[model samples]
Target chain A: MTAENVTAADPDTTVRAPVPSERRGPSSSAPRMLWGLVVLVAVSALALTTDGFVSVANARAILSSVSFTGILAVGTVVIMLSGNLFSLSIGTSAAVSSMLFLYLLPDVGFVLAVLLTLVAGYATFALQGAIVGRLDGNAIIVTIGAGALQVGAVTWLLPGSVQVPDGVDIGFLTRSVLGLPFPLYVFLAVALLVQCWLHYSATGRQVELVGENKAAARAAGLPTGKLVTVAFAVAGLCTAITGILLAGFNQNANLAVSGTFTFDAIAAAIVGGSSVIGGRGSAARAVLGAVIIATIANMLLLRGFGTGVRVLVEGIVVVLVVVAAQRRKRSIA
Target chain B: MTTRPGMARLARRSRRGGLPYVLLVVMLLVFVVLPVVAGQQVTSFNYYNLFQVFASLGLLSVALGLTMIAGEFDLSVLGTYAFAGLVAVKLGADDPVVGLLAALVLAALIGALQGALVAWFRLPSAAVSLGVYIALLGLTATISDSKTVPYNNLNVSDVLDRQYLEIFSLRSIIAILAVAAIAVTMTYTRFGRDVRAIGSDRRASLRIGVRVDSILVVLFVLSALLSALGGSMLALSLAAATPDPGFDPLIFALTAVLLGGVSLRGGTGTVLGIAAGILTLSLLRELLTVLATPTYVSSLATGGLLLVVAFAAAPGLNAWWLSMRRPTKRVAEPPSLSRVG
Candidate 1:
């Protein structure tokens, strides 16, 4: 899970080598710095102007809301670094794992069900990674197919919502600490570890190398297939974690709201300065993206917009951010 | 990498005559022969039901196939379907023809807007169109008030409802005509050649003086317009519209495009092939439903087909595997090695 950054300093592993521009683009602090300031200004303005924006309860709500998307974004960033673009299947992965977690909870109890779900998540995503990387399949179609398969399976097999067992103590996963839910800590911990690995580890650098140029990476003797597989596996693990925690947060396993999570995660990653072209950004930035989306979504709610409006607003924001990111990339090139 | 599959298919097609017939035979086995044998569904198959289902998705797959021919993904076609359907159903309460024209024009304009972003502004078609899609979905829901409109009040268009021999509807005929128009355009027109040429190699097309960006815009607009037609036909057939039709139709459309052997990487295949794909899926769904299986199972099958179609279409796995077998095959890097060494 952790990469060895020290080993990444081999003469051939130099970051300053003739890597793709996206690999070097992150080294310049301009786009990231601009994003941070924009987020800061937006937050300050909202806090100053809105009535309930600064409340601890709203802050807590925002934190809880962002945990799933934030964690998902971290995984998406890794896949992007590998240059596969995205997995449209992340939402389905969450829904499948969460539904499976609930389904198995009554039968296998808690720990075992959670464990089984984690494995399922890994296998599901790993299959996609294998097909896309090993067989050189298109990422978009593979992911879209995988997503449809997962959702259809759940719909056909599970059919409806399942409740948590009465005696299973699911309270621990969502219990509050310092005005924030436990899930927030989980998100932060995952982001911290991923940030460290991506910025300071050998495998992390290899992931970048593969993403920056699959051909170049292969020419340089890197194991491109295995690295890509690992990236998807990481995404699956994160999605599975989110799934289990969501069951705890909602006190039930549900499939009614399976639409927005995957797109939101991709939006967060793009907003956080991660290039869809791969080999850029960090988990820390993805965390920033999640927070930004959360704040905007929360703000829309506070302003009396319906759920539909909120979704529309999120799409507008993503479009704007992607356009800006594209402009920046073009300028840098 | 994205273009590899389509390019490979074109390459293979050039080297072999009658390959398309072989593919058509394979498609028949999957779409017709297998379903008939597995469930005896052929006798139970209703022509009206089949063509009704075919009317919407068939157009959608053809529309999507055209864009893929032009070397881009149009995830927004589904979005256009919903949006244009929303407009037509809402406005048709007064006049159906006006509603149809409005939907078509708006759909085309919306498509052109997205195409401008991809062509003029140089945005990634997938991501940008995805944003457009999500937004359109949300807008459709919002404008429709998040409820299924009964649509009982609207006067049905006489043209859309006109029946031929009590089996073939005018709407289905229109859909077939649209497909024919697109096929003729792709096969016989300079625009068609340029679109395929652009998909095969954009830079080369540009170097040969094709108006690459404008042609891309036209292809996108055509896709959008057809998607709207599909939606309008759906509204007419169902006599209702839902805020969300979900994505089952989109998946089926994509599956049809792939199954009919249209390449996702673009610049290959035919309207006839895409129609065959649509027929396969539409009939498959009808068979599954008639067999007392849940409708969701069709979606599951759709997912499976997506993977299979994408895999089959690539046409490059053997060559790629051969290359993989040869390690240390370091093709030399061009100069500017070591950053301008």
Candidate 2:
């Protein structure tokens, strides 16, 4: 969402505000200029050194890989902005959703099954959101508890093994239509829609206000609790969609892979510069962040580091990104 | 805005004494009493075992609660725990002292890196830790070859296998020691004060001249250290280190802490409460097992409990509803202000 920048008319006023010095530069062509140069340098380096790093086919693959994470990150961005921390159960919820899809596909057609999953996700997330925001419950604790419950549910419901039936396919959701995969298109469309919702809608604006200052927002007569609940519900819908797509992506839904997706989604959001404090973020940035992390993941696999090495590398990278973001925030403050 | 101040104050005062005590009694009855009333063997071992399970889980919960109380989340604790276990098992096989040191050092380093980023750089600990968790998970998988690292050493296995090692036994000497240490550190130490101050109000804390940044970093490192220790011990007891064990600790430990009255917003509750919380949950689990409940029922039961506890533990949940019917309310309520003002 684009924040309406309120610039001071006088330089004296700008200097007097408690704005962190690092965020201040000559308001003229300085910060943007510096950032532009950094981007240019990075692009040039990629162009000169890497093989197929910028190729269309590789880009398509990266896009496809990032779609689910992008959706997840976008959903999280909404919740995070609304001032809650990690949706501890998201991974588990997604896992359960994916598993449910495969388990139910035989009983219900693929379309109905997916539609039902979206509803389930929305309800689950919304209830949690209500408990957290309306009741002032702790987000992290509630989610963790919910996650444990979900894990148990999944394990118990499909004990030992469960699989998607063979020969049943969702070609429409998975097949490539243009240079990009269908999932990639879905991701972009969803991103665009979220961006529109966040930027243009009254409720979206209210969501930002709640995130910015929940007490103040509530005092101001905004339905801070309702917005938070909706934000989580939206997160649920997005994550469930990602789960369904993932099942189709792998052609099977497995519970074991849920952990990776959960962590990665958070990683992508943080990398993209989403604020953990809530109220400051964008769908575009969130998706881009997901792509960067996913790309790194893809590179690790390509390099044959195996799962362990990949995990280590990913952790290290997150540490680096976190450090950088933190430094920037501190300097700004 | 129209309510009388005297009346409001009277109602609030009465609520402070009445509400939480009532809720606590109700919770104890539902989870603790009903099961015990059903049967003696059913209740005692179940509750005892539950206490044991929670005592182990409480160690990690305290660690997590410490960081969270400081307004940060550290998912890296899972990695730290797993890595600690892996290192301990790998090295302890050769020498227990070496294994212990390696695990502590690794966990500390992970904590330091994450803490520095969060405290000094001002990064959101949640995102950073997510990355850290993924990496650590990967590392654990790689180092353990995606398989369980069994405690093959006879001496180590024997130490772990002793019945005394279980919670409620002398073997839980380590668990008791840990709880005591945490109690002292949290209540008596300067760092603990700073953590509480910061968690309660970061801006005010900073203005008051607390080194909020460094304190957070140190606490995170400390939390990780504690978690790693717990994890290593757990692995030893189980005679194996598995990639999946850390997840339960992550969730259950945190849940117990919250249920025990540790507010997720931080600056509330005590180590004692957290320990009690863990014991309560562990006991409940054990009781369920003893009841011969169907396999699928436990999850639904756990979920229901979590929801109930979540509501129960919510800030002001008890009084918020009751205060509605009271005759008085605060008159000088702060007027709704501009969102950005």
Candidate 3:
């Protein structure tokens, strides 16, 4: 029997049948548009009612605050799209990358430091990808182990905090571009590039196919392992961008700086309506998710709600999205 | 008739599941015996400390192992641990038992909710539990006001920590008894068999009338209770609770579960293996402490061990190794001949 027929014959495999393309047509886009409209109205209402919410400074604050998380979320989208699930090591990888950037800034100059830091991030995640793809290790557990190893090794080798030496120039990274922070621009650029790549590229489609049904993809002779590894490599590059920008913006780096990056990135991706099970998300959607979270957090800060409430709401939103998506999938099937 | 075959399968599976125990023995020899042989004074106090750590983290490991064996991942255990610790400390200041009861009750509710969502919707437990995890952390922060809560009765800690028989304490004894009870239940009960059957194939179990949803709910509730009990005990012993207990407990629990020979794919593992894994880790920690090595070394060792174990456990590793060993096998045998054979 053909692989497709075999997969269809298996009841267990049939449960997770690849969502039809027709379902992603008008049916999906309509609800997505409505959600966008609702968000716009809500943001407008918040601006009209709340004091200081409409100002450019507040806007800059919100964008810049979410820039690093947004970048990391975009990376998370790639991993999810390729069916690797979330990388729990984003925070540690970012922290390690930031430390590397700072440590290299004085010796190698800004451009070289950034390039080398990106390479390190890519290499680190590529190794994890190799294990997950080539060796069939559990993605979540592999990332967790990698996170611990990074934290332990960094703590043993580097000082508690790293700072660029005197006379080193990294102001270009922190400088504004068209009235927005440099990191914000990077977030936008990365989102646009990745979104286009996922939509238009052959490899990206193969990634989505692999994520939809890995066994089927393997049967079809697709390079599932290589595609998964490429997804992870792209994610690593995005994380490295966040790390470099964070170091440049803060003018120093520390182990604790990326404390909530992993969770926050995950929250962004899921809230963006991305399936945690994989193959149905984009960088643009992740950016929107990040923006929504940041705006809500900003509003909460203005209204005197603590960080706890903001985080509580974020968690609620993720759970709602996940449940809603599952219900929708069930109905569609 | 059905259970007979299942039991025999389990028996055969467990006979091969002796790696964790062997690892435990090796760790004991390296960490406990070697230290004493090197003229390091091994006192009852050391054993006391070792069991104290074991009782707390060991419970968490067992909780995680149970859920994993039932084909679900409960990431909220860490959040539950921290929240329960804070709840026990803040509310149980006057009466420790009340605090523990309240914590367990709350944990049960949380577990039930998460279990229902996952079971009813057929959602991924990892994602669902992660949401609960975040919410629990937020709840913990709100209750503790993002600060450490101190118990009014410091004597409670002293009582819990009071050593007996050179090693066992009140807390350790409770933990050990709980583990023993669970081990027995898992080995000699219909519930245990159903859990394994479900993990092996959820749809098949459902078709076979396994009551998959309810069993999953009970497993989650049990896991949450164990974690809460562990957290409450730790809080009482420490005489304080923090909003964040950090990721160390989760990491340690996961490492222990994996090292215990529990497959991430689920449906295969023993509670005794989990206990041995926990003991091995505890001894390693004690060894590091005795050596006065830097704290990060333990983290490095634990992380490295997790990676090594994960890599070793990968399904493709065996296939890759076989292919590597006989690189010319495919060339030597043509496709048609191989298929005919």
Among the numbered candidates, top DockQ falls to 3
**What lDDT is obtained when candidate 2 is compared to the true structure?**
0.72
Q: Order candidates by lDDT, high to low.
A: 3, 1, 2
For A160-185, candidate 1 gives per-residue lDDT tens digits of 88788778888988998876789999
Between candidates 1 and 2, the one scoring higher on lDDT is 1
Deviation (Å) of B164 in candidate 3: 1.6
Could you tell me which 10 consecutive residues in candidate 3 chain A have the lowest summed lDDT?
A1-10
Off by over 4 Å in 1: A1-19, A22-48, A328-333, B1-11, B14-45, B154-162, B320-341
Give per-residue CA lDDT, model 1, range B1-341, as digits (tens).
97999999888776433343455556445655665566656542355656766678888888888888777887888888878777888887777778788989999998898887778756777777777877787788788777876566434745666667766788888888888888898889998889988887776787889997799888889999999999977885577776677666677787788777666667777777777777767766766765667767777788998888777665446545656786433222222234433
Best by TM-score: 3
Q: Cα deviation in Å at residue B324, candidate 1?
A: 8.9
The residue ranges of model 2 lying beyond 4 angstroms of the native Cα positions read A1-57, A102-111, A154-169, A257-259, A328-333, B1-55, B69-72, B164-171, B188-195, B203-214, B316-341
| Chain A TM-score values for every predicted structure, listed in order | 0.88, 0.83, 0.90
lDDT (Cα, tens digit) per residue for candidate 2, span B9-47: 889756643443444456556665666677744534443
lDDT of 3 by residue, A151-199 (tens): 8999999888998779987888889888888888889999999998898
State the fnat of candidate 3 relative to the true structure. Answer: 0.50
- The DockQ assigned to candidate 2 is 0.41
User: Per-residue CA lDDT of candidate 3, range B79-177, in tens?
Assistant: 888889988988897899899999999999998888888888878888888888888887877787888888879888988988889889999999899
Q: How would the docking of model 2 be graded?
A: acceptable
